[model samples]
Target: MSKIGNDHLTETRDHLINEIDSLSESQLNWKSNLESWSIAQVCHHLVLVEESTIKAIAWGVKAGEPTQSERKKVEQHILDRTKKIIAPKIVEPDTKLFEMQQIKDLLNDSRIKLHSLLSTVEDKSMLAKKSVKHPALGELRLDQWIEQIYLHEQRHIEQIKEIRSLYEELTEAFSSDHIQ
Candidate 1:
């Protein structure tokens, strides 16, 4: 496993935790509009994606044949908020409201599973030789898939920030009305 990939994953997860650590249940579950997701939902989605990605990576490493495919530079593309990507049904967050601690625990558990799986790989270099099919990104090397997990999380961290901003704005507006 590459130290860079591990560092990116750790950094992104830490940032995500800091972003939502102080949020109340209402703040975590509050959506700016009916069509948007709350902070909790965003974290739930990240958990789902990471879990699925772990399975994919495991399968690719064990059963997949080695390929010399060129790696796609998709980090910047994943971080771009200009393009809105719809979540697939499998990865969609349910309507159940999640507590902040529950969301944090879920994220940490998923991270542990991913790291554990990576550590068990017999050959670290196989990560770059094996390929997996990403829904939109086409064939990605196993290592790239690992990187994609954090890149995807970083993207949603931005979304969570936006949700928090909107939540604060609405709360301030409501408070102002009550004060009047």
Candidate 2:
């Protein structure tokens, strides 16, 4: 049961925070296509992933029985959903506030909360122990889960950059029309 380093989680959080800070408002709301989700939706999806992970962690703490496959599935689900959110076909663009300026702050909030929870846990010992057994991945140590978490965020950041580029290209066309 190899445990993950405490610092790894912190580092991953920092990288994600930086990624979120790089986007502008239009980029946050821009959908790449009619079937894709906007950058704002990507943020919202992350919130869901966190919520689900918290639930899985809680379950692991109590029962210690989610199977390795189940744990792997959990991590993969987070990854897939995040990818979908950041790179989905542009669904009908909805009317709403994107407020991407606040993403940096939000990521900060996420870090604070995650660290607080990690610090309070008496089961750091269990970090290496199988708190939950996944159905396929078997039982993963905390370190493995943390690694997956970083990769999941990496996918989204990549998508965020892509979304920003698309926004730029499309808006350039609009600006050109105005210039003419």
TM-score of each: 0.96, 0.68
Whole-model alpha-carbon lDDT for candidate 2: 0.58
Clashes found in each candidate (C-alpha, N, C closer than 3 A):
0, 25
Query: After best superposition, candidate 2 residue 110: deviation in angstroms?
Result: 3.1
lDDT of each: 0.89, 0.58
Q: What would the per-residue lDDT of candidate 2 be over residues 1-180, giving only the tens digit for each residue?
A: 123545655666677667667676767777877667787776665554544445555566566453333234545655564344332223222346468656556555655665565666675656545454433244655545545555666667677777777788889999999999
**Candidate number with greatest lDDT:** 1
Off by over 4 Å in 1: none
Lowest-sum lDDT 10-residue window in model 1: 61-70
Off by over 4 Å in 2: 1-5, 64-96, 131-142
Predicted structure 1: clash tally: 0
The TM-score of predicted model 1 comes to: 0.96
